[model samples]
Target chain A: MIEFLNSIQNSLIYKNFFLVLSGLDNTILLLLISLPVGFVLALLFALGRVSKIALLSRTIASYIFVIRGTPLLVQIYLIYFGLGSVKFIRESFLWYALKEPFWCGVIALTINTVAYGAEIFRGGIQSIEKSQVESGLSLGFGKFLLLRKIILPIALRKVLPSYGNELILMVKATSLVSLTTYMEMTGIARKIMAKTFAPVEAFIAAGILYLFLNFLMVQFVKYLEWKYNPHLRLNN
Target chain B: MFKFDKLVFGDAGWGDEFLIATLMTLLVSILSMGLGLFLAIITVWAKLIQNKITRFIANFYTTVIRGVPELLVIYLIFFGGNAVVMSIAKVFGYNKYIELNALTIATIAIAVISATYSSEVLRASYLTISKGQIEAARALGMNKFSIFFKVISPQVIRHALPGIGNVWQITLKDTSLISVTGLVEIMRQSRISSNVEHSPLTFLITAAILYLCLTTISSRVFKTLELNYSKGFST
Candidate 1:
């Protein structure tokens, strides 16, 4: 059994197992860049969706509709290749940033997640009881203050579970960054598989990494959920 | 203003290729949705009526499929499908290289993803059916299969149509990912055109617009289905 284990470990394919460990950096970087940007955009788009003004609401609706309707792969291709084709963008100061696959991927992922997150937030906002808004008004709160103190907090708390799912999705979606030439986990896995001809081991490793990230995200979201749930805390 | 001239039938434009690709996209999406719906029915039935083992199997299927990214699922199927098929064939003493077509691969991938959503919808619809109604049917001497078709199935379809429509749209959008496997769907065709013409913006924009068109038409159809299904149930 010890000899068998040594043989498994000594396989030429397993020699570079540590290379996959370095891939976690790219994975973490992609998540760190995309998540906060996605959150801000989601907030703006959600506000636009629930805005009183017809034009603001309609424009946001169209943006959300179009983005949600299309596949993220097409969006990535369009931003990376399509936007890159424009002479203005090519010549602009932003060209340097756009040239990097990392930034390009972050841009695509941020846009896709914003669209989904906005919808989730909008649903949460819509589901908020009108009596709460009335109470906020009775407390002499203006629209902005009410949104800040009451509406936004409740909406965000309510939407946290779904947003947690979205976060996990973004972790997995970062695999597509490989298409843009960013050597994230899946990208590295593909390379390793190509060299060693062991697709199952490489892919299985990548899948485990993804599952691990998702498991962490689930735990983090659960902590946030517990922290925010006043009723549960009061009982405890 | 957008002009139809570029979209008109001619060799100079993408009109013919786009049309053909759109058809292919629809074909793939419909085939996948049909397969998913069939799988979902069995899964829902298994989860609802079968033993604990069957229920566990059904739950495991849904949980794994839903938890993973659709892209990963597609990749797994794309790479592994042919090998698995060939191995199965070899066991039967048929060792010739049987090429799994791109459409079949895409259909299976998308169907596997769609089945999770479809099964969820079916299970929800099943739960929404009143238990008393089933008991009444049984009391009236209706067998399980007979009662299921005559009562439960129609109502479930009616209730599940909107959810199913959402799944269809999702499947439609996901077909764009099949380009990775070299399928000549709209997205793939557009990518080819973009590369050849060096006009990525125009081609990608056109592709996005075509997708919007498909989704908008589908939303309308789903709305009509919802209305039609609600006619008798609502005042």
Candidate 2:
């Protein structure tokens, strides 16, 4: 039985499975670093969309539209090869950060997800009943303070489910990091397939990893929604 | 700044190549979207069926397809499909290897992903039809097919227009990933031009402009459809 198990473990399928699994760290890192960065930017963009200044709101809306309309792959390529080729960018202080493929991947993923997450957040903010805002204003809360103390808390809860989908999308978008030569899960799978010519097995393993990660994210978001919305739970 | 002349029609320009690639992207996306709609109809039917196993399988299909990265799905279908076909051929006493066209593989991959989203949208649209309406149609002795055509489909299309528009936008962008499989779509053509010209920024930006155009036009078309469908309804 030990010999039989050893033979199974020593097979190419098992070897490639574990090899692809080893790259999960890069994938996780991309998701963790980009998501928080994206969340901050998304909140800002969402706020900008609803700002009193027409120019700021219009500019932010156009930024959201352009980003949404283009492909993430094109954006990734534009940041990496396109920006990297510019002599001005090379000489600038930003080059130190932009020179690396990992950072490029993070920047692309964060910016793309911000476009999506911002829209969701804007919807959440807009969905707040007008009467609630008026009551807060009548209670002597300043606009910024009202947003900080009252509006955001409620809006964030409303945005959780949609934001969860955006989170999953970012996780998927990270797979495109391979195009920039960064070794994430999909990158590792591609390498394994190239060397062994067994793309089926390699990609299947990678797909399973992605599916598992997304499942966890979905569950976590659901838990947050449940915990945050006590009123709905009590009513039920 | 790059020379604008290089983008114009000439032997030194990529205008013709870029135009061809744009058409390729449109063709592949349209075909896949049609396939996705067909698949979604079947998936929705399976989900709405009164059997536990079918529902479970349908649920599993959508969850897995939607949850996984589309690039991985593309890779899986391209390579895994070849393997599966080769193995099946071997079992049939055929020794030759089989090669599937990258475009077909890409269309199937994108269609599978699009179908999951389409199914969810279609299912939601179907649910919006009042149950009483269906029962009333049945009470009038209308068959399932007649009830679906006369009652359900029009409303579903009206309700599903926006969601389907969202799906089309996603599908259009996703055709970019098919470039990895060597389809000479806009993204792939742009990459080639960029590499040859050593001006990655210019080519990529141009590609982005073309993509933006495609999406903007389609969104307008979908808006028209939505307006036409919601004609009598108040805003």
Best candidate according to TM-score: 2
In model 1, which runs have C-alpha deviations exceeding 4 angstroms? Answer: A7-19, A232-235, B1-8
Q: Which stretches of candidate 2 lie over 4 Å from their true place?
A: A1-8, A234-236, B88-95
| Candidate 2 CAPRI grade | high
Residues B106-220 of candidate 2: C-alpha lDDT, one tens digit per residue: 8998999999999999999999999999999999999999998999999999999999999999999999999999999999999999999999888999999999999999999
DockQ, per-model, please?
A: 0.51, 0.88
Q: Per-residue lDDT tens digits of candidate 2, residues A1-236?
A: 99999998987777887898899999999888999989999999999999899999999999899999999999999999999989999999989979999999999999898889889999999999989899999999998899987899999999898898888888888999988999989999999999999887788778888889998999999999999999889666
- Residue lDDT tens for model 1, A104-178: 999999999999999999999999999999999999999899999999999999999989988987887888888
Best by DockQ: 2
Tell me the number of clashing residue pairs for each predicted model. 0, 0
Per residue, candidate 1 scores C-alpha lDDT tens digits across B88-189 of 999999999998999999999999989988999989998999999999999999998999899899889898998999889989998988887899999999
In model 1, what lDDT does residue A26 have? 96
Each prediction's interface RMSD?
2.4, 0.8
